[model samples]
Target: MTCLICGTPYQSTPTWSKLFLNQLDSSTCTRCFEKFEVSESTIDFTDFLGTPYEGAVDSVFCLYTYNEPMKEFLHQYKFLQDVALAKVFAGNLQQAFQTREGIIVPIPMHPEKLELRTFAQVDELLNAAQVSYQQLLVKTKSETQGKKTKMERLETSNLFEAMSNIEATNYILFDDIYTTGATIHHAAKILKDAGAKRVDAITLIKG
Candidate 1:
């Protein structure tokens, strides 16, 4: 098999070992895996975007730093539509987050963007990690955040809305990357307003 990130060929291993490793490997070679800068601290949204709405997201857990390698990985996986590359982070996510009773809600994609991308990148990440989630939120706007300035992005709230009545008191929001903290805060505000008692978030990288 080939390494997903670097395209390096996997060294030959015993049949038994290969079978065992295949079940756990994320298609990332050891060298490439070592290159990733694992996050050693928790992220505070208030530090980036000031205080969030009352009773919004409590905290955010990020897995890695959004360095150049991670940026390239996301560009390939999301923009280039390399679907299979989702597996490269599946094992890492599963290890970072264990299943819990609360709902796992992936950050929603705008309908128009969804039509173009074919799938939500966060949803694909959760699927590859074998994590179950609910599609409770929907993007109300189609404007891409990449085009917006920092001030505009921060001011651009109300981008997401709950699709229906939410009964869950606890929720875990999932996303591929955290940039200005606007997206997660806005999404979590809607969840909290819909009766979520405590909302937390997890992201693959903090940009």
Candidate 2:
């Protein structure tokens, strides 16, 4: 098989060592795996919002930098619909951090976009990692973030809405990428307004 991120060929034979390492490496070749630079910093949500939002996201734990390899991987996994590539980050995500008793909420996709894409990328990542999550939020707007400019993305409003009353106090919002922080911030606001006490987020890449 080929490395998911770099496309370098490697042995796919099942063995004890390979199986043990696969749990940690997600089948990525050694060189490509080493290329993923782990983030030691966090993004503050308040920086993106012009005015302070009530119950804003506390912090975001991003895993990888939006480097060329990660960019190509995301484009293929998300845009090109290479669903199997979701496994590439599953191991990293599962080990990113521990959550204090709360539901893992994936940033919601609008029904129209879901119909076209046939899957939510974040949900697929959690699934590959065997992490349980709740689809508690929904995107009210059908707009795609990739086409929007920085200002437009930041100024966009009412993009997300809570589906129902959540009994959980803490929620971990998951997404594929964090570009301007608009998407996760808006989603966290909705969750907070719906009675979520604290909202934290995790993204595969910090662009």
- Superposition TM-score, candidate 2 onto the true structure: 0.85
Off by over 4 Å in 1: 11-23, 47-54, 99-101, 149-151
- Using TM-score as the measure, the top candidate is 1
Q: Residues 80-125, candidate 2, lDDT per residue (tens digit)?
A: 9989888887767776634445689999788898888888888999
Off by over 4 Å in 2: 6-25, 48-55, 97-100, 146-152
Quickly count the clashes in candidate 1. 0
Candidate 1 lDDT over residue span 1-207, tens digit each: 888888988753445534763434578777877787887776655544454453477888889998888888989999999998888888778755674447889998888888899877889898898888899999998887889886687666689989988985888999998877778888998999888888988999988
Index of the highest-lDDT prediction: 1
